[model samples]
Target: MTRTTSALVVESAGAEPQLALVTLDSLRVNGVLVEMYVTGVCHTDLGCMEGYLPVQFPNVFGHEGAGVVLETGNGVTDL
Candidate 1:
Protein backbone atom coordinates (compact mmCIF):
# COMPACT_ATOMS: atom_id res chain seq x y z
CA MET A 1 0.00 0.00 0.00
CA THR A 2 1.08 3.59 -0.75
CA ARG A 3 0.38 6.63 1.32
CA THR A 4 0.40 10.09 -0.22
CA THR A 5 1.57 13.02 1.90
CA SER A 6 1.43 16.69 1.00
CA ALA A 7 4.62 18.53 1.94
CA LEU A 8 6.19 21.92 1.37
CA VAL A 9 9.62 22.00 -0.21
CA VAL A 10 12.20 24.62 0.72
CA GLU A 11 14.40 25.45 -2.22
CA SER A 12 15.70 28.74 -0.88
CA ALA A 13 14.43 31.59 1.23
CA GLY A 14 15.01 34.26 -1.38
CA ALA A 15 16.87 32.28 -4.01
CA GLU A 16 15.59 28.72 -4.38
CA PRO A 17 12.06 27.84 -5.40
CA GLN A 18 10.03 25.54 -3.20
CA LEU A 19 7.69 22.75 -4.25
CA ALA A 20 5.01 20.44 -2.85
CA LEU A 21 4.61 16.75 -3.48
CA VAL A 22 3.27 13.49 -2.05
CA THR A 23 6.05 10.98 -1.70
CA LEU A 24 6.10 7.27 -0.85
CA ASP A 25 7.23 5.94 2.53
CA SER A 26 7.91 2.61 4.22
CA LEU A 27 7.67 3.18 7.95
CA ARG A 28 5.26 5.42 9.86
CA VAL A 29 5.15 7.08 13.27
CA ASN A 30 2.27 6.97 15.74
CA GLY A 31 1.69 10.68 16.25
CA VAL A 32 1.76 11.17 12.53
CA LEU A 33 -1.50 12.43 10.97
CA VAL A 34 -2.78 14.05 7.81
CA GLU A 35 -3.69 17.71 7.26
CA MET A 36 -7.03 17.59 5.54
CA TYR A 37 -8.03 21.27 5.71
CA VAL A 38 -6.62 23.86 3.38
CA THR A 39 -3.08 24.90 4.17
CA GLY A 40 -1.96 28.42 3.32
CA VAL A 41 1.53 29.30 2.15
CA CYS A 42 3.27 32.20 3.86
CA HIS A 43 6.44 34.30 3.60
CA THR A 44 8.35 31.91 5.82
CA ASP A 45 7.50 29.22 3.32
CA LEU A 46 8.96 31.37 0.58
CA GLY A 47 12.21 31.78 2.48
CA CYS A 48 12.56 28.08 3.03
CA MET A 49 11.33 27.22 -0.42
CA GLU A 50 13.77 29.56 -2.12
CA GLY A 51 16.68 28.30 -0.05
CA TYR A 52 17.20 31.81 1.22
CA LEU A 53 18.19 30.08 4.43
CA PRO A 54 19.99 26.79 4.75
CA VAL A 55 17.47 23.94 5.01
CA GLN A 56 17.36 20.19 4.68
CA PHE A 57 16.52 19.07 1.19
CA PRO A 58 13.59 16.81 0.21
CA ASN A 59 12.05 17.35 3.63
CA VAL A 60 8.81 18.80 4.88
CA PHE A 61 9.51 22.49 5.63
CA GLY A 62 6.19 23.73 6.89
CA HIS A 63 6.65 25.30 10.34
CA GLU A 64 3.41 27.27 10.62
CA GLY A 65 1.49 24.32 9.27
CA ALA A 66 -1.99 23.10 10.21
CA GLY A 67 -3.14 19.49 10.32
CA VAL A 68 -4.95 16.81 12.27
CA VAL A 69 -3.78 13.76 14.18
CA LEU A 70 -3.85 10.90 11.78
CA GLU A 71 -1.77 8.25 13.56
CA THR A 72 -0.23 7.97 16.99
CA GLY A 73 3.19 6.67 17.96
CA ASN A 74 3.91 3.79 20.34
CA GLY A 75 4.06 6.02 23.43
CA VAL A 76 1.61 8.63 22.19
CA THR A 77 -1.54 8.64 24.27
CA ASP A 78 -2.74 12.25 24.12
CA LEU A 79 -4.67 12.84 20.95
Candidate 2:
Protein backbone atom coordinates (compact mmCIF):
# COMPACT_ATOMS: atom_id res chain seq x y z
CA MET A 1 0.00 0.00 0.00
CA THR A 2 1.05 3.59 -0.57
CA ARG A 3 0.42 6.57 1.68
CA THR A 4 1.28 10.26 1.76
CA THR A 5 2.04 12.64 4.61
CA SER A 6 3.16 16.19 5.26
CA ALA A 7 6.67 16.94 6.44
CA LEU A 8 9.04 19.80 7.19
CA VAL A 9 11.69 19.59 4.53
CA VAL A 10 14.93 21.45 3.98
CA GLU A 11 15.73 21.40 0.30
CA SER A 12 19.38 22.23 0.79
CA ALA A 13 21.89 23.80 3.10
CA GLY A 14 20.76 27.28 4.15
CA ALA A 15 17.28 26.63 2.86
CA GLU A 16 14.33 27.39 5.08
CA PRO A 17 12.04 24.66 6.25
CA GLN A 18 8.97 24.08 4.15
CA LEU A 19 5.82 22.06 4.41
CA ALA A 20 5.90 19.34 1.81
CA LEU A 21 3.99 16.22 0.94
CA VAL A 22 5.87 12.93 1.17
CA THR A 23 5.05 9.35 0.29
CA LEU A 24 5.14 6.35 2.55
CA ASP A 25 5.87 2.70 1.93
CA SER A 26 4.02 -0.25 3.36
CA LEU A 27 4.92 -0.67 6.99
CA ARG A 28 7.45 -3.37 7.67
CA VAL A 29 6.89 -6.06 10.23
CA ASN A 30 6.94 -4.56 13.75
CA GLY A 31 6.85 -1.10 12.28
CA VAL A 32 4.76 1.69 13.73
CA LEU A 33 3.43 4.98 12.39
CA VAL A 34 3.28 7.93 14.73
CA GLU A 35 1.40 11.21 14.47
CA MET A 36 3.49 13.79 16.27
CA TYR A 37 1.57 16.27 18.35
CA VAL A 38 4.54 17.84 20.08
CA THR A 39 7.95 18.50 18.56
CA GLY A 40 10.87 20.85 19.09
CA VAL A 41 13.80 21.89 16.98
CA CYS A 42 16.97 22.16 18.99
CA HIS A 43 20.29 23.79 18.21
CA THR A 44 21.36 20.76 16.22
CA ASP A 45 18.57 21.27 13.73
CA LEU A 46 19.31 24.98 13.53
CA GLY A 47 22.94 24.19 12.89
CA CYS A 48 22.01 21.91 10.05
CA MET A 49 19.68 24.51 8.59
CA GLU A 50 22.47 27.08 8.81
CA GLY A 51 24.94 24.82 7.02
CA TYR A 52 27.06 24.45 10.13
CA LEU A 53 26.63 20.69 10.24
CA PRO A 54 28.01 18.07 7.90
CA VAL A 55 24.68 16.37 7.33
CA GLN A 56 23.52 16.04 3.74
CA PHE A 57 20.89 18.20 2.17
CA PRO A 58 17.19 17.41 1.67
CA ASN A 59 16.91 16.24 5.23
CA VAL A 60 14.07 15.51 7.57
CA PHE A 61 14.95 16.58 11.10
CA GLY A 62 13.13 17.02 14.41
CA HIS A 63 13.78 13.81 16.25
CA GLU A 64 12.89 15.43 19.56
CA GLY A 65 9.17 14.86 19.60
CA ALA A 66 6.32 12.96 21.08
CA GLY A 67 3.46 11.34 19.24
CA VAL A 68 0.63 8.90 19.26
CA VAL A 69 0.98 5.59 17.51
CA LEU A 70 -1.62 5.64 14.78
CA GLU A 71 -0.88 2.20 13.38
CA THR A 72 1.15 -0.85 14.20
CA GLY A 73 2.25 -3.46 11.73
CA ASN A 74 2.38 -7.20 11.98
CA GLY A 75 4.68 -8.66 14.64
CA VAL A 76 3.95 -5.75 16.93
CA THR A 77 2.96 -7.29 20.23
CA ASP A 78 2.94 -4.24 22.49
CA LEU A 79 2.03 -0.62 22.12
lDDT of 1 by residue, 18-69 (tens): 4566765633554455555656667766666676766676545445556775
lDDT of 1 at 29: 53
Indicate the TM-score of model 2: 0.81
Measured against the true structure, the TM-scores of the candidates, in listed sequence, are 0.53, 0.81
lDDT of 2 by residue, 13-77 (tens): 98888999989888888899898888999999999888998898788889899999989999999
Highest TM-score model number: 2
Candidate 2: count of backbone clashes, pairs at least 3 residues apart or interchain:
0
Model 2 segments beyond 4 Å from truth?
none
Q: How accurate is candidate 2 locally (lDDT)?
A: 0.89
Query: Which 10 consecutive positions of candidate 1 have the poorest summed lDDT?
Result: 10-19
